[model samples]
Target: MLRTLTRQSPLFTSSVRGFKTSAAAFVKAGDSVPSLTLHENSPGNTVDLAEETKTGKYVIIGVPGAYSPACSASHVPGYISRGGELAAKGVDGVFVVAVNDSFVTKAWGAELTQGKDSKVPVRFIADHAGDFATKWDVLFDASKFFGNKRSKRYAAVVENGKVQNAWIEPDSTGLDVSTAEKVVGQL
Candidate 1:
């Protein structure tokens, strides 16, 4: 007879099952994106993914935090600093996404683009409670971050509503795998 497993072991079977369930909805390369409308911070105008990706190359960048050390110093700034170069290579639009509110996203976008004079302006978009993150499979339980959730550091290059490339960090939070330089290189 097979012995029934209990929660006595160091590892919980339920935890493993939950992990598998959570990992199943992730978006991957060659997968078409779902239709969603995201707004630009200032204008508050809804941008439809179906429409945006139909005409040009758009890059969706996900950040764990807006002003964190790695993100502020390198991840976002790296893209803002080199927006032109990326644009020149046929990138039509660049968007930064986070699990913050619309207001915070607006402020961060303005701050990031200040004094850059970049032709390819980066739009900081609020995922608003990780709805977008959940859809993209990038949401993390970052209670330490802000007593709530946050997005993973990853980048997806979309063309015509289809993912041309997806660079996701294995560790959930880090600058090692995902960066503008690396993502742009894929384009």
Candidate 2:
């Protein structure tokens, strides 16, 4: 009888696994942000994410790496190309966040924006030490990926510091749910 009950309880068995094995990612709509104090690439300014989102609406776009194919070719460009439209649609701030250091983010920004003064008008920031990624629970082991930890592809739209929408990828590096088009639709 005891063995049958134990085998029957899938929910109970899963509850014990906790954060490590769960495919279901955390951040959900209406959840308050965890922290601020992130590093931006340009001029090396340290930004407080919470403070920046206070204006109106903010979009946090996370990618596996700064210069990865999907990220550079599509993920970022999708946002960069539409930055004006998004802003015109009434978004206050749009940020691209990656797990790499600030320098890489800056360079990636330049490349994506075509070396203009500010091609996208979006801030390209780095989450050094994986602080932001960890807080958001989107950080993943990427030892084989460019020799470092990396952020899983995801996007969040925040309003007044609360998440209005969260689209986390099922596969750590997949871009299905977190694409710019999806985020824009949410906005």
Tell me the whole-model lDDT of each prediction, alpha carbons only.
Answer: 0.77, 0.80
Give each model a TM-score. 0.82, 0.80
CA shift at 6, candidate 2, in angstroms? Answer: 24
Best of the candidates, lDDT? 2
Give the residue spans of candidate 2 off by over 4 A. Answer: 1-25, 42-44, 115-120
Worst 10 residues of 1 by lDDT: 15-24
Clashing pairs in 2: none
Q: What lDDT is obtained when candidate 1 is compared to the true structure?
A: 0.77
Tens digits of per-residue lDDT for model 2, 1-187:
8888888988547655455555655678987776667888743688878777766778888888988999988887888777776776677767898887888888888778774332236888888778888888888889886688888898888888889888888888887888888777767
Model 2 backbone overlap count: 0
lDDT of 2: 0.80
